[model samples]
Target: MGLNEAPLLFNFEVESSENFTFIPMSVRFNLDRFGLRITLAQWQMLPLEDRKLLARFPVDDDTEIEPNFDHALFEMLRTHANVEPEWFTPEEAPLWRRTDSVPEGVTHQAGLAGLTAPSVARWAELDPFKRYVLAKLSRKPEANHDFVPAMKEFGGGA
Candidate 1:
């Protein structure tokens, strides 16, 4: 099934028991990014009470979900994953570098920091995720100071 179908596939109910406190299953991280896919085997490994708690956790569209793992059961699943996540190299991932789409503030900041054309091209060659992070950081007022450091870390000249 597709990612859109993931929630539906795991949907079900469990009887509540006084012995087990059913907390919401909302851990704050994107499980998909970590390549953690909990399936029936992992679910079965968890105690019935833990299962009940997980079933109640809701998923939302917010990306700022903090990496909260207060739940012991959730931590166990992450640590002992049934499936491993496929890692990607910088070249393998998607590229989002469009010179026109890049905000002028970012370019100005880079220029002020003494980043030349070669440096800018190097920045463009960075993983799209890193580029995205730089773009986001560059848009903040008075945040341009971080731009050069980030560029240096990403293989651009200072």
Candidate 2:
């Protein structure tokens, strides 16, 4: 996600040893999931000592850092910001989507939609995430037993 969408928690400008220039860094949290994104203008801004510390862990291209690193990073950030981490139960987590983006394959499936007019209509009213789940379940190559249950759970089926 871009900076606009992410909630900015902190911004740090660290001095680089090479040219004594200050580099901009930001710590942003994504509401889509529980994660943080750290942006550094140049990799050189990271101290060799800090690099050595993180070398033991696998850092992937995706912003989702390793759990160990994540915990340490958050702890360090919390210490700097003087704030505690907010906790949320599963039930309190934000819903993934609010509208459906239905695919043509799903709309045209005779076997899937022929006998489920009411369910299909109800599916249109479900949140995008629920619709996505149902669509995915419906498109499986193998026998799909979960579609009906999912529809029922969402009040889509009789």
lDDT of 1 by residue, 6-70 (tens): 22111111122222232212321233323244544555566654444443333432324422323
lDDT of each: 0.43, 0.39
Backbone clashes in model 2: 0
Among these predictions, the greatest lDDT belongs to 1
- Residue 56's lDDT in candidate 2: 36
Q: Whole-model lDDT, candidate 2?
A: 0.39
The RMSD of every model to the true structure, in order and in angstroms, is: 16.3, 17.1
How far in Å is the alpha carbon of 74 misplaced in model 1? 14
Worst 10-residue lDDT window for candidate 1 reads: 5-14
